[model samples]
Target: MTPPPYMGRTFPETTSHYLTTGTDVLDSAGVEAALKAVTSKGYGPVAGAQLVLLCNEREADLISTWRRGLPSREATADEVAADANAVGPTAKYDFVLSASAPAYLTDETIVGRQAPSDFNGLPVFDSYGEAFVIKSELIPAGYVIAAATGGPNSEGNPIAIRQHPNAAYQGFREIPGAEQYPLINSYCQRSFGVGARHRGAAAVLQVTEDATYTAPTFAV
Candidate 1:
């Protein structure tokens, strides 16, 4: 019988090299305007009723960005009313504010009602619009995100996770070892990808006045 091909192969032999690359699509003019509007003015005291204005601005900008992808048309009376009084299930956008933002919106004038012990969001409203401001510790200071929510067939969802079609390749899978002894060896592998879905469905505000934007650093 012929000897195995790798009978005397070196342990550290080089196999094949693989390279991966990715790219990001640039923001549209409308999205760029939305980002600029929020960041143009630096952070200041958003205490008391000012929180309502802030949430309105964020939500309006997000809506403007989403509308850029569609044809221009006059908003219906119902749509205008919905935008002006959005609350609870009618809210079209979610304001994910920085963790520290809750402190500024705690005033009785802004809160308007006694919140339930389990409630974690503060609903803010202006004459033009409204949204629920949710605080997230993961969000860096001076940053907020207004993301569209609740649409037919995941229409407004901004993020997506894709995986291999085969169930065995979707998540972690155990690789059988060459050895047949009782003490078996193995390895695990998985394949998946994650990325932004609806580009205009979300807007990120840096909350600064600097000409250029700076990404925040997180401490592990």
Candidate 2:
């Protein structure tokens, strides 16, 4: 049975090595930009009113370094080495932002439909009917309820079918590893994805290896 090769390193042990490390190519700022780009695609009329960006530490560091300006060109080789080392392992940074917006909520807001109730009959307890309901009057004529169904590798879950851009999330699986017999034979792999859920709700700047310092275009 080979005794399971002495369990050189458990899955958790190997995966924890990169707890403080980050992707070499992408940075946090780039992540925010990517998200902005996705949302920039005009998901709907009232988009970007509420926005959020998520990223790993490496990505955040990349954005921070770019904000502070890269090391000077006139610095010594040692300085350059130190600066880059500080930057750590960066890969070919690349990302595209996408935006999606669901059909405009007729009234663009939710309203309470029920006052109060006491269904259980507890003297100290008071309950209410469905607290909120879509306003039939507010729904525009010819409005059709939008619902999503199937998706790749999904089970019995509601399909994401809002009338906005669907961020087909991509990139990075397990990090590739180097072979070493039975012990330490593989390394952890990580990647990132970016997207938005509303039209005109997000602003993104396209960033790639060719241009990291350029400003993000405001146009979706």
Candidate 3:
């Protein structure tokens, strides 16, 4: 048999990259503006509520950054509301305010534990998973639930009249104290609605929060 490529023989290792273009061409500032606005609007409703920072850095750090990022320009607020409108209630939020790698979660109002110096970066957890991390009462919750056949990847038709009760319950498993774990490849939590799964809601908050200077980042 042929030796594996590396130190002996070699075989081609390749992957394809994709191109994604928005409906309109936006400048760097425009892009930044949109991001700022949408995130700002999101906070408006949950201004004082505890938030989680689920990226690489501390959750508290992420929360601080989000609040500060909001008001630097007045347009940010509107931009946020606009994003909400565009996404509708059922989809995910547009950005990630937490640190990268291992998909860390930060409480919007609290500071997290110190990170180790020997931190291994989490690369696989990117946007697609990021898009799925949502807030509120998610149908099936935000997380993927085990299929009703009690099997993996067995998500059956949600609309069938005889759907399994667990189809929805098994779907959204919460990451308890999610703000502390290193960034996991996950979806963005944007609201309090439980979404399609349940006949009720989880904890849906309004779409706005108040802002003030948070520690770490200087006022923009």
* lDDT scores in order: 0.38, 0.27, 0.25
Question: 39-141, model 1: which lDDT tens digit per residue?
Answer: 2221111211111122334333443333223422234355468796422112222223332334454322332332222222443321212333444455655
TM-score of model number 3: 0.17
Backbone clash count for every predicted candidate, in the order shown: 0, 33, 59
Worst window of 10 by summed lDDT in candidate 1: 16-25
As a whole number from 0 to 100, the lDDT of residue 196 in candidate 2 is: 26
Regions of model 1 farther than 4 Å from truth: 1-130, 150-155, 179-183, 218-220
Q: Per-candidate TM vs. native?
A: 0.39, 0.20, 0.17
Error of 1 at 212 (Å): 3.0
Task: Give the range of the ten consecutive residues with the poorest summed lDDT in model 3.
Answer: 198-207
- Candidate 3 residues 5-28, lDDT tens each? 333434333311111112122112
Better of 2 and 3 by lDDT: 2
TM-score-based ranking: 1, 2, 3
Q: Quote the positional error of residue 220 for candidate 1 in Å.
A: 7.0
Most lDDT-accurate candidate = 1
Global CA lDDT computed for model 2: 0.27
Residue 172 error, candidate 1, Å:
2.9
